[model samples]
Target chain A: MNDYHNRRGFLKKSAITTLASLVGTKIMFAENIPARVTPLPLLSDSVDGKDPEMTVLSDRPMNMEAPAHLLDDPVTPINKMFIRNNGLPPVKESIDRSAWTLTIDGESVKQKRTYTISELKQRFKPHTYQLVLECGGNGRSGYYPPASGNQWSQGAVHCAAWTGIRLKDILADVGLKDNAVYIGYYGKDIHLSRDAKKVVISRGVPIKKALEDETLIAWAVNGDDIPLFHGAPLRLVIGGWPASVSGKWLHTISVRNIVHDGPKMGGSSYRVPVIPVQPGEKVEETEENFRIIESMPVKSLITHPKSGAVLSSNRSLSVRGHAWAGDLEVTEVNVSIDYGCTWQKANLSAPKNRLAWQQWSAKIDFPQNGYYEIWVKATDSKGVSQPMVMPQWNPKGYLNNACHRIAVKVVV
Target chain B: MNVRRVTLAVAAFFVIAMGITCVSDLRNDQTTTDTTATTSLVDTLNYDPHSGLVVDTTLGLVVANCSGCHSTELIRKSRFTRDGWIAKIRWMQKEQNLWDLGKNEKSILDYLEKYYSPSSLDARAQMRREPLDDIQWYDYQ
Candidate 1:
């Protein structure tokens, strides 16, 4: 009799759970949440890790849904254009123009020096590049096992015409000391807690790379003084590298003989698995030493007809999106209309300079409808193409370059 | 006399708040979970009365097991099975640095085992309503 009762009770609960699962847990949460309160502010985009000063792709980076954000015109307006930032946004809106300072120290032959934002602009003619700044953990939220860092959704990235003085000019002034192994930098962010430790908050570039003319200490985005969330006053624009290494809200830069180390540096924070593992499966460091995090890998996404978009019959759909590769230049972009089975080359819009995402387009003949999947693959000039799957997964989400796929629905 | 009393109360409140805010970030109690080869760095230590960082029990078992070397993002976004979870967990623990389980570990694993218990079901049930559906979707798939 007791067993019969237990079984009956179990059946009732099972029936209820099945119903809930059908409706979607994510949907249910949305229904219950009040209209006024914001829901998850998920990090919005995936970034190429190479250029630290670069930005997130997708026409609209306001939120994290992929399939590439589309723009009717070639140029994404400055306001509607995507925005991405690493770490926390600066707390101050108008940091005291007088109080802010830039310090250059470390392995330089000359002693350390500090300068204000005004002095930086005054001393050097500001150079401009329509560059993109992306986070190392741009799509980090997509990491398996859900690392405990910022529960960033996708929008933690953006692109703009960053304008500033040449980084080489500044380094040349002090004269690069011969033993310098890395160039390290820090920002104005002081955690609310004095004793709280930070994970790999600092990043470095090989001294040899610092000599390039493309690098700069940028103060403007587009034509405007960078807004606070975009790192106001001054930020580093490391051409062809990951945004992590390109410091944001930069204040201090040091040339050092040793590899930078801290919670954020030389730790398990940015490791890739020794071997490829199943999705969500952990990857361990094998016999070999861990590899250092560096430049962005090749990746691309379809922007127009945002995934699941309803299309007009044979409307001459102009498929457009953006593609990026770290350090290396994007040689070609391939778009697949029949999903991953086939591919076609896309015409890259103007060369917006290699440091920024070059817009690409393919005109596809929209035919009779069923659910259609669009796939885009990018190949760097170096021949590295975005893979359909990442090699493996790691704890602190690092580089992810799986080809982005979008599903489209058709209606008569 | 009433004004004086009010002033004292306000001043005391400020002092207490300032004190708490100053010391709140210093609590790095290191508790390492070997399964994910994860040391309880900042998040575990930076406990806030209001932080929404608690691990979902069933999910936590899966994550704690997987995060040995990698992170929990893989689990959260997976569109997996009882065998999938188990197979992946074994790979993580054996091949990766995922922790070897303890007696308490089974509780979480059981929960995940029972939940992710195989079936091509995506658990996107609408338990709660959209907060801003009225304002319109925020954009993205």
Candidate 2:
């Protein structure tokens, strides 16, 4: 009698489970039904050895950004550095490092000059400095109405020690003319389409920024040869400016009397609004309305006790993160535990160089077990602090330096 | 006798389910044909994983013409109006060394406008709903 009852109970539960599964499947199918469900390839699935945590915006042009929690170190590792490519990387097999040459010429150049990788090492004094290279669209996803570009989050910036010869030293050897107003760089990466133009990305800076001691024509990163994806044979390393100014696979340096009109220089590509505009407001793209985005704004990120983390209420938690400002020092970092109700100063560390990011940390005790939010705001030496909310929106979504907020739960 | 009746009933149910699935599939195919068949070159093609673009009617032209220089992601990520798409093609031709598309330009524009129009209401709403609040904040310790 007991066996009969048990069998009946098992059959009843199985029937209910089957019915539930069928209903669930129907709902899922209905929701996914589209006019034409065309299958598009998933880029992240095709790539190998990529950090599974990193977000892959696109695979072909190979634009990927590291996860914020993974970017906790003061010095980002080579693999962790975000990859932002405008075009396909050159064929690795065809790269002849020994034969590689960089030419220096333009209207403002007194005479044309060329230097091989080995010659550059032998002739010029090598210098090393830890600097931060950040994408101009680091926080593009925060923009309202969305911008037209790779929607990057906070991990589009990385700090690393680069070893290279000073760019000014090379320019001095080439003899810059008095009229040299702008400097432009060109690379070997070609357009993917055969009929398309030869140049991929060619950008430059003013003569003054070009001559800065921190500017380098880098051959190595973090004491090792730069990886092929990061620009193998050689690349430029202009500190404190948008990374676009520092061309990769660099081959040519042109000293021009006027601003260089490269592939990415025009058409509101890297330019931002000249003045603050309302968020999500549509504006016309004109030279008078927008200007080239140069130095980045002051920014900070909270790395520790990650958002949505669970912690013990009885214990004091230490918070830590990195802070940086382009062409300026991070003078202070303040942490607020009670949703900005009270702020405590975090201890800031000195940067290794002028353009490197400073590390900041603070320890706080949770009053009671519940939900808590920690906010971090960084101030530059110029007294500019990161805004509490996202700053004015621009066409390209550049320079979003809002204070970092982390929400955590404390339990008994 | 009872077993035979149960088997027949199951078979009938499967047949009806398959008929419904086939009808829905045909409906989807017809919708695509109606929209994309304005050009003569619309052919059923397999998905190509390398370019991340569908291998349908106008896709072959796009892959043949565009993917040779850059990844298809550049095209896929952008959403523009019909005029905006035309303007981009013109800009590419004038400045970026893109060759003339000739007669294929019309078909290409049609395909892009149909498949990749400016963010639809549903897609825009979905993107807007993606929570920025959950983004992991990083700091130094």
Candidate 3:
């Protein structure tokens, strides 16, 4: 709760109020990327070269009524990864690789320097850690009446083996300045304001999050180059934070005395309530204010046999899926077959780092599987666990961590 | 200037500024303009040459189908593949009362693929392909 309390004029902050006046004109959100290798399927099911275990939702909806679970591997394969973009997917062309650079120039670093993706890979010892990346709006649609933006269902999080140079590795080289209190990042997503002004969205991570070893300046995913739909070339990988602020197609890193107050940070998006409002209520700034969204809650989901999966035998089955608490270590995971009536602690096998999600496995035998429900709850080392029900909703629809339940059928 | 004169001047200035700002904002508000800033974003967000980002036939089809009711930003921010868009189109037609255009959906999708495919580059660049390590500027340039 530190550094929060800045909701001075919280009231009168409706999206419609802002929508009426609209900020920066709609110059172009981007110059735009053309599609290629087309004349094919509508939804991109081509997760070529990806492992099927980790990516059940990449090609299709998580079989909503069926049971789905996470893979036990630490690193997420490019093809098995889940994507939750708020808009259209951008195409990456080979010619577009004009060797862009990343400059570390925040208040913390001394004698800032630029490094190419290759230079970064070679200059610093390549570090690989398995972690979970979840969208800030993951499970937001469950907000009742739909809180607006992205309208994401459940498929927004992914656990992956992220390989890259550690933020500490780069910061040590840059030499932190004494006055540096925060680290600000700017990505390459460009959108024009209605005022004909070009706006580049910039976000900031507190110095605490930036200095963690698990936080990486990643350029590769799953041993190969990262894919474009994913943050390619290079991106900021915050071990346990909201996905939107991670800034895909990342460009600049600046250390500052205070928070990055660009539209992306202060005025435009990622704002949520510092405290939870009751469930089924719209967060009216006039009544309750919202703050910047940060770390994700401890969460988990079932990935095996699919919800509503009909297994022939009544034997016990292996239950697997990813469990994580952004930046925090998941100490224990609990599963409930009767929808939270009784819970069984799951076995959590964490990967290399504390910040990343742990691949969990558990076993349960169903006596009768007629429209059965399976729910998973995770608790962090900090003693935080996913709640059984949501308190309420906010303007941006953030931090949705109700029990993740899957339904599967049993056939003899 | 007197108090009233100064007040009038300030109000006049605000009005004039809003007018000029309004006209340009109106155009961009409706559509994303193709320019250096946007291209730079394309270049930065992308890993490869980003030649696919250039406006082409695929873009036209996308504009016709996806943007029929909403702005391109609605389609642009989505990170799904061809199939993802199709699911959305199907949802729009079935769930939200969008009419099926027989087969125009394919063309619109093809165009979107060309203009909006996600870039799949390495988390880090190859060593041999490393650009100069000297302190260059951020592509923020």
Candidate 4:
């Protein structure tokens, strides 16, 4: 045991020395301090049959994310989709597909209307679109001086074919009053405390976004009825915006005359800086300094040659990834093999759906690489490209679209 | 200056090596007894099987009150000041169906503040990457 400790200590010291020499810094060691507190076992591990690859940030009010490498599919599988919930999910026993009702009301509605799940399917034309739904804090772990929410290291996003009625069609049929400005949504999921007054989550988008052709009151994902965790029977799927705006276990839609200030919509909850701030600088959460995040920026992820992957030196490597822009189409994707010193265009596949992510792949010859990094950058139809570094610092760490970097080693 | 620094570093390393040896000898003598006591203490805590939440006697009340509705993970994940925890509790009582703690509120606040206080700015900054040193140029043959 003593020898084991000595050997481990010597190895750690040697590693520090090498790192210090490479970075040209004097490394100091602290005694008795554990290098890191043991991270808790993922909550998914305890579940009967959950995806083992997911990083579980919390168990109750369950939040788990699939690692970026596991999310390489063009359409994210239902079982692999990330889960983010503000409150406890409704019990399985309480779910009654036939009895589910969606109530539409508010001062802005000329006449309050309620529709059952069956009625919604019978009354409206069903449209299907492949849409992306991403959490506002998708890449929050990359933020310096880490933010307060789940430290999602990307992969808090998924694109799936949604089968539902257009939200605009519902708004038109219900007859929106002239005063209606914002569309608020409510869900059946309750707070863990069973507090009668506390709402788990209630959020919405502006009337214009609510009326978009792509916005939907979805009943199905990936050609199947939405799973319970992803919101079963019925849920709102507002593409292009943060998934929070697309309330799950959806039951109510309220047309308000003012911007909805429901839970998770107030203060700087889902808001980002209006103008870029210095990295790691603190800024007060004020209305003028920040705005409610909308329309995500163009982003790409390198799925192949995942960070720390080993490749053969002699073989030509085929790098592949996925790219998407919120609401807008991704026009170009470029890969950098030499730390952005030079860029090579990658072939982008046509998206299967209007709002779906496009797959891109490129082949490159490694020039006897010791260590190599592949960077992927994407641009939207609006000509907005992802920044090389994080855009700005925000209190809650929302809307991070920094270019993705993947490190790989080539072995002879 | 470089030579002097190297010599000092070597001397300091030897001193640390000697110190560790002395400590290791003492630790080995007590290892068996210490391991048993630690195992018993850990067992007594009766950590939540699902969430791995440590619920010692000091925090047993919190586990009992909070875990009935939500997993202990929610409470463990949150880091807040005394006021922040109070505000959250009040918010839960007002909005969510959390019942008033009544007299136990102060104890809850004290426990939460002790265990889950907001990390200081310096502590957070220490987690940031140090600025990269200037690159030394090398000639490739």
* Highest lDDT model number: 2
DockQ of 1: 0.03
DockQ metric, candidate 3? 0.02
lDDT of 1 by residue, A1-412 (tens): 0111111111123323443454345333333222112122111223211221122222111222221353223333444443443344455754765678889888554677787888887887878876645556655544444443343433344456778898878877767777878788887653322223532167768777766666778887667776665566677778556566667678888888776653356645455555555555544444254566667677666666655556544434667777778766788999886856778888986557756777788876656765566778999888888766442456556676667666655554
> Candidate 4 lDDT, tens digit per residue, A235-302?
99987789899899999999999989788887678987777776645567777887888888899988
User: Which ten contiguous residues of candidate 2 chain B have the minimum total lDDT?
Assistant: B33-42
**For model 1 chain A, where is the 10-residue window of minimal lDDT?**
A1-10
Order of the predicted models by DockQ, top scorer first? 4, 2, 1, 3
Per-residue alpha-carbon lDDT of candidate 1 for residues B1-141, written as tens digits (9 for 90 to 100)? 000122234444543454345334344432211111011111232221111122333444444454443333333233244555565667546533456677745675555453233221211122111111111222222
lDDT of model 3, residue A38: 14
The local lDDT score (0 to 100) that residue A399 gets in candidate 4 is 83
Better of 3 and 4 by DockQ: 4
Residue A386 of model 3, lDDT score = 84
Clashing pairs in 4: A194-B97, A195-B96, A195-B97, A196-B97, A197-B95, A198-B95, A198-B96
Candidate 2, A214-256: lDDT as tens digits: 9999999988988776887899998788888889999999999
Each model's lDDT comes to 0.52, 0.71, 0.55, 0.70
All candidates: TM-score of chain A: 0.76, 0.87, 0.77, 0.87
Q: Which 10-residue span in candidate 4 chain A carries the lowest summed lDDT?
A: A1-10
Please give the lDDT score at residue A322 for candidate 1.
Answer: 76
Per-model TM values vs. the true structure:
0.63, 0.75, 0.62, 0.76
- Arrange candidates by lDDT, descending: 2, 4, 3, 1
lDDT of 3 at A222: 71
> For candidate 3, what is the TM-score?
0.62
Q: Residue B48 CA error for candidate 4 (Å)?
A: 8.4
